[model samples]
Target: MTFSIVARSGQALGIAVASKFLAVGAVVPAAEAGAGAVATQAAANLRYLPQGLALLRTGVPPADVVAGLVAADRERAHRQVGIVGPEGPGATYTGEECLDWAGGRAGDGYAIQGNILTGPEVVEAMESAWLSSPQEELDRRLLAVLAAGDAAGGDRRGRQSAALYVVSPGAGYGGGSDVACDLRVDDHPDPVGELRRLRDVHELLFGTPDPGTLLDLSGELKEEVQSLVAERGYASLDMWVGVENLENRLVSGKIDPVVLARLRDAAPDGK
Candidate 1:
């Protein structure tokens, strides 16, 4: 019922997921910065997420938590799970009673799990794609893995929703917003594809630019700026500023006397 990426940042770890079920997020995953992440699915026990996270917060290992939860659950045989904890602790559990072909895989840094899926091969494809995919940012890499799973078969019942989230101390997820990107496709023809498109827009706005923001000018910097814009097929300050999308209030036809004198004094040639 869920697919998610859980990751650590400066002082936090984030968990993001989506599913057809209502508030599937509340049921399928848990994450903490110093602790770790866990995904419990297939007749999912929603309590496991918070309980698992709490155990992890106490420095318990991910495998142990999985084992403990399985031991306590009477229906453990029908469950599917994936866990990754601090320092590379990872594990996956697929009970025999789980619906046809249900299973999961755990890797060095991630876990892929699914149930009532098209087949065991679906989870296998997810794991392979995640491991072999070109190295990229966590969200992008994760989307690729989910996309691969879908292509391989995915949930036999069909897809419904998708989500993405990341937590960082200062880096904005998109366009300087404090929250890194938090997006959802609750209902879509191709939910994962839609989420991927949103992530692309996030990168365009937040990703580092190929050409750095640089400013260089000859003669009086302000005047040179003015002159350069005018030479660039613009007629006046208004036209230059308009083409550059600079606010008009920041400049005028005549520099204020004080500002003009300061610029003149600062200029090497004292224009």
Candidate 2:
């Protein structure tokens, strides 16, 4: 019913998933900063989420974690799980009783898995995308992997939900939590594509401004900024930015380049 990847990128870890199931994010993906991440599906045992992370936190290897979790469950044969621990390579498991098109793969720093998928090619495409882009940030990398699986025919039953979740120490909003990126498309005809759009908006709203891309706040640029905010009845650019909860991206009195683009896109008549 789902295809997911559990992975690590430097100090951050994440899970990206799409499924025929509603709110797959709430059930399948779980992770902790500096600990590990897991994808539990195919009659997913939610208990494996906390339990797997606990094991990984206790220095249990990912392979052993998979072993111990299934061993303890009376319904092991109906479960499928993947784990990437605090260190080393990742691990994956598929129950004998899982749906006809279910399987998984584990490798360096990541694991890719799915159930009721089109075929093995779904996971194969995911693995290829994950490996091909070793240098992307964690959130982007995981999204790319999920997108590949989606393109190859994820969840033979069809798509309804998708999610991208990532965590890194002090990476959350204002460095308040472990969650760095969390986006979900709980119900959509093109959930994967919707996820990509949401991810772009997430970056626009929450991502830090790149100094290299900062635009000069003078002349026509400054005038345009003021006009865009006024279109929404705000007298100042800062007011609109604050109202939109984009103050973080408005650094040092300068608006983020993406925010400016967004303003232009939102303007009436494409002004």
Candidate 3:
């Protein structure tokens, strides 16, 4: 009923999951820095999240955490869990008697897990998606992998909800919302599609803006900046022109070729 990707970023960890079950996001996903990520599914016991995080807090490795959980849980054989730590420690567990189509993958900085799923192909596809993709922002890369799982016959029960969470480096709890992105699809006919829309919105606001700087300019430079801004796609060069730090550049009347290249990249395709 759940498929998730738990991953470690530069200094943070993230978890993203989707399932036909309600609140699946809450139960199947957990993450913590200095520790690792955990996904407990298939007759999941929610306590595993806190316990796993606590173990991680004590500097327990991912493999050890999985071992500890199995030893403690009376029903460990019936449970399915996957873990990946900051140091790249990884492990996967599947009870022999799990409801079929249950398994997982553990890698350098990520774990892909699912159970009572469509089939083993679901886990295979998820892992493939995760491994084949190039490194990128955890949010984008993780979601891309999840979407690929859906394309590969995700949950047999179908989709209902999903969410994504990532902590920022040096951010305290409730620290000015260091959560780079937090989104949930509580209910949707197309949760993944809605997730993509929301992620796109997130990128527009938080992703890098096109290269932009201001300078006092001569006739031609001023005209060029104005034209770029008026073209309906480029950022207004005037926005930075008067700034004290950038004043020198503006006064130069000619943009540096390197700077112009950056701006062009940002506004490529006139976007």
Candidate 4:
């Protein structure tokens, strides 16, 4: 019915999940910055999300959290879960009653699990992608793994929805929240691909530019930037930066080379 990966990358924690069920994101994934991530599905015990994060915040190891949750549940045999914390490796569990082809794999900083998947290859491909994908952002890595699983014959029942949820301190809009990335394909025939498309849009709209990569906006370059912004219907260069949420990297009224490049890409005549 589903395939998922929960992982910890640097200061971020995230979960990526795909399912044959609609709105799987609303029920299967949860994470807290600097704490951990969890995916509870296959007769998911929603309590595992909050309780598991609470235990993780209190310094409980991921394995201990999984054990405690299963111990307390009378219907444990019907549940499947994956957990990864800010420190140490990850943990996962697939109950006996889950549909055929159900299983899981866990490794340093990540866990991959599935029920009603084609076979172990689904999780295996996810693990390979998570360990090998070159995406620096945790959410992108998670999405890569989800895409890998889908390519490896993901949910035996086919796709309906997919989601990516990631958190890091001060990573959200305006740097005021921990939700670095949260996107969902509530229903789609190619939900993982839809998720990838949305992730790209999210990056363009919300991603912060690297200070090391910024190109100075001055003299003729500044004039070019102003022209570009105005051509895009902005009243001023500053207005363009504000609308694109690039203020964090475009302060001092200087434009980022990436921003200039994006503006050029959006040129009405494709010049």
Candidate 5:
């Protein structure tokens, strides 16, 4: 019913999943910054998500954790799972009684699994995309992996939902939480494309500013920006940024060009 990839990149743990089922995000993906990621589908034992991370937190290897989980379940023969822990190696498990075309692959930093898929090519495409993807942020990379599978004819039942979840130390808004990027398309004719659009907007609003693009607000440029800010009804430039939730685009008295353009676009008149 679902296809998923659980992977580790640098210090990030992430999962990208899509299914014929609805709201897959609410149930399929889970990860902790320094612990691990888990995807439980096909007769999914929801407890495996939390329990898997707990085991990884305690230094249990992914293979051993999967072994323990399956061994303890009466429905072991029908479950499908993937795990990537803080330690030794990643692992994937497809139960003996899972639906046709069910299987998995695990090695190095990723585990890919799918059940009731159009064909084995779905998993193959995901694995290839993950292995060959550019050195970009984990969020983007995982989405590429998901899209690859989706293009390969994803779940034979059809697409309805998709999600991408990633976690890393101090990666959330204002460095407040471990959750990095969490986007979902609960039900859509093109869930993967919708997921990609949400990610693009997320990057615009919350992505880290590029250090090389930071510009000092000074002299004539500063005065012009001040005028734009005042034109928008804010007493100061910083106030304008605060009012519009653009604080993440401002840093140490400097601004990214994209943020400046955004302000210019919103001022009372053209720049």
Candidate 6:
């Protein structure tokens, strides 16, 4: 019982999923920045993750990857999958044996699918949100679609877990890897809501602030920023930013006004 979206835009690729099963993220989602993404569920064949990604890496079209994967599986009739890459096209498959409300839709850069869902509206809502979301980041777009699907009557069986997985070359913490984002709500009454909350926090900690939108750190604001940093046992603002993994949000040596405000509000002693 799961719903998911696999998408590619520019150089980013990712997957967002929700389900009545536990840790659906671990079981259904897989992606590689600059290559492609895949979501395998409803009698998932775990092999599709690596194999699909491998196929994408080899420049195979997403539709071909889906065909190859389903062809290689003996139980393909029960499996559901979605795939998208940076080029060619996207594809989705819902086996004939999938539950009653099973189906999927493919678009310019995305594939939306589900099984044991409330109805076709679930995937439709997801597609609408993915297309209309104003966010430029693939992760945010994915989350928005998941939220939309949840609102549209997600898994008919009920929700237990949700996840957002993304990949981008050199986008991980400290530019050490490609795992741009990987957030999961293993078990929660409102996993989609929890996942949204985590996505916001992830952005605050890892998203790079726009230079045009950055607030200048100077005068009284600068002193306040320094005071907050020192209170946290950091010797300098840069140290605090680094320690908090705010490199992306605090690109310039100068502090971002939003960051300064958050630090002040988060001060343990309310300094």
Each model's lDDT comes to 0.63, 0.89, 0.72, 0.89, 0.90, 0.89
Give Cα distance to truth, residue 177, candidate 6, Å.
Answer: 1.1
Candidate 2, residue 216: Cα displacement in angstroms equals 3.0
In candidate 3, stretches whose alpha carbon ends up further than 4 angstroms from where it belongs are 170-178, 208-271
Q: List the residue pairs that clash in candidate 6.
A: none
Give the C-alpha miss distance for residue 267 in model 2, angstroms: 3.8
Which portions of model 1 miss their true places by more than 4 Å? Answer: 2-23, 168-179, 205-271
Q: TM-scores, in order shown?
A: 0.69, 0.93, 0.74, 0.92, 0.94, 0.93
Q: Write the per-residue lDDT of candidate 6 for residues 108-201, one digit (tens) a residue.
A: 8899999999999999999889888646678878888999999999999998999999988998987999999999999999999999999999
Name the best candidate (by lDDT).
5
lDDT of 4 by residue, 7-115 (tens): 9988999999999999999999999998899999999999999999999999899999999999999999999999999999899999999997999999889989999
lDDT of 1 by residue, 218-249 (tens): 35765764654445555544654334333322
Q: How far in Å is the alpha carbon of 186 misplaced in model 1?
A: 0.9
TM-score of 6: 0.93
Model 3, residue 239: distance off in Å is 14
Q: How many clashing pairs per prediction, in order?
A: 1, 0, 4, 0, 0, 0
lDDT of 1 at 102: 73
Q: What would the per-residue lDDT of candidate 3 be over residues 4-87, giving only the tens digit for each residue?
A: 888776777777788888766667877765667788888887888899889988888888998999899999878888887777
Candidate 1 clashing pairs? 173-180
The whole-model C-alpha lDDT of candidate 2 against the native structure comes to 0.89
- Residue 41 in candidate 3, Cα distance off native in Å: 1.6
Clashing pairs in 2: none
Over 1-271, each residue of candidate 2 has an lDDT whose tens digit, in order, gives 9999999988899999999988888889899998899989999999999999999998899999999999999999999999997679999999999997999988989998999999999999999999999989988888889989999988999989999999999999999999999889999999999999999888877888889888878898898888877787787777777777777788655667877877777654333
- Please report the TM-score between candidate 3 and the true structure: 0.74
The candidate 1 region of ten consecutive residues with least summed lDDT is 244-253
